[model samples]
Target: MRKLYVIGIGAGDPDQVTMQAVKAMRRAEAFFVIGKGDQKRELVEVRTAILAEHVEGPARVIEIADPPRDRAPADYTEVVRDWHERRAELLEAAFDQVEGTGAILVWGDPALYDSTLRMVEHVLARGRSAFDYEVIPGVTSVAALAARHRMVLHRIGEPVHVTTGRRLREEGLGEGSTVVMLDGDCSFTEVPGDDVRIWWGAYLGMPDETLIEGPLREVEKEIVTRRAELRAAKGWIMDIYLLRAAEVRHAES
Candidate 1:
């Protein structure tokens, strides 16, 4: 391929797609899709639907089967590095089969907790194939979560820390407010203190979207229960949440 576009479509909602993303999608002759296995076929469907709704004609889609990796790894960094290398191999081979401008649609933004951009870089660093690439930014799940809850991220002039569930478990909450992602364990339950409040959301934009909010101690159990039930029903789940120390004064405007 002569060129590629790494586009972020948004958290989940089709309406979240921006005009910049639409333009980038139109410019590409084919799309290289990755990581949509049987368990999450609906994810690829959402991307396909986005293309159908925005593009002038039918768009070409190329599916690349993802290599399996250890989900619960003893050494997280090394395992993830090896997995990305494997993914880069697949992406390189897939790109070679197709010609002309192509794009890879990424969930959420490519910068946060997604590996598409890294794998793309890996493909180029191998020097096997060369293609100029551009990134199209889209609304992030963090933004979507904040919007859904109708709340600001932090108090006046305070910081908002964005972290993973594992890190939250290890480091505990940071100053000001905390937004946790990629948390499968419901780490909010691990957060100490009854003074914390939480606003959580799942399936941010899709039809089955769910939201819950209240003091952490009071609603943590409910959030955990609902998360399990949703995952059981759908076989997959994507969720994010914000936690704040309730004792932090709500400064007067």
Candidate 2:
């Protein structure tokens, strides 16, 4: 049976690639790339640069076109489920083509917002492919954000809440620090509070990396404008932010 390695390639910086991830990459006979199309071509290049820098031996790269997903859906979970099912089918086909160790390089960590691991499980659940798989973790964007900002995720002994921008908008702020990801809409703007401080970063770990930190009310508009300009210039953007309500932090302390 062929083996598959799901390796995390860090958030955006090529240097963030771990030695363990490099070892896994070297073992793979072919690297399975899930293409995100032309908009995210920079990401594709980052993956390629990792392989070029770490994998010294001959390796084949197989590109798998990602299944289209609904950008906005009334039933988000259902749309995602359908997209995953379609993705799993494509992965099954790609896996069937390889005979030796295969790999899928995931952005950030596979355990985070990424769905590659789930798709891999879906492929196996179909009973069509037989292969053992392993996950090599990488530094997540959240960690990169903290490191870049020189701040902790949460106050002493408090739980850190990691969530999507949509969820943050719906659920409002929790008791502890909240880290928001996949928020294309700048959901932080919807979070109501004058005392909240936001540490926001985009294209983290890469050359175009940008960071903004200030009272949410003061910097929210700047973030929105900057994000728009960045996206318009690059055609795509991947950003994450940590929103800390000063009142909550003071109360918890």
Candidate 3:
């Protein structure tokens, strides 16, 4: 039976790649890359740089064109389910090509907001392939954001909620701190309330990294404008933000 390694390469910074992740990469015969396409070609370049910097010796890199999906659909869950199925099919084909060891390097920890693991499970459930696999964790953008901001995720004893932008917009802010990811719209602006404090970061761990922290209303416009500028200039942006009620900060103080 063949083997597969799903390794987290960290959010953006190459140094965030752990020694464990390095070991996993060295073990693989071919690294399966999900092509991010031209607009985000810099993303692909970053991945290649990681391979070049750590994986020493010539390594085979297999590029898999990512399947398209509906970014916005009435049934978000069903659309995503279909997209995962399509991804599973492509991965299954790639896994079949590697005779021994193969891998897929994921950004952030596989457990958090990443679908690579689900796609791998889907391939196995399809009953067409059988391969033992392992997951090697890496630093997440959430951690990167916290470290860059030099602050903890939440006030002592309070729970922190991590969610997507769409969910944040729909559900509003919950108790404690709310960390939002995958928000195409600076949903932070929609979070409501001048009392909410926000700490936001984009291109985390990379050279273009940006950070903004202030009362939600005070900096929401700055975040939106900066985010737009970054996106327009670079053609893409990856960001995450943490929001806390003003009273919570006072309590911590």
| Rank order (by lDDT, best first) | 1, 2, 3
Model 1 clash pairs are: none
Segments in model 3 whose C-alpha atoms lie over 4 Å from true places = 248-253
Candidate 2: how large is its RMSD?
1.8
Q: Scored by CA lDDT, what does every candidate get? A: 0.93, 0.92, 0.92
lDDT of 3 by residue, 1-253 (tens): 7999999999999999999999999988999989878888888788889999988788798888888888889999999999999999999998888899998989889999999999999999999999999999989999999999999999878899999999998999989999999999898888778798999999999999999998988889899999999999999999999999965334555
- lDDT value, candidate 1, whole model: 0.93
How many backbone clashes does every candidate have? 0, 0, 0
The 10 consecutive residues of candidate 3 with the worst lDDT sum are: 244-253
In candidate 2, what are the lDDT values of residues 1-253, reduced to their tens digit? 7899999999888999999999999999999999989998888888888898998865688889998988899999999999999999999998888998999999999999999999999999999889999999999999999999999898887889999999998999877899999998899989987899999999999999999999999999999999999999999999999998875324565
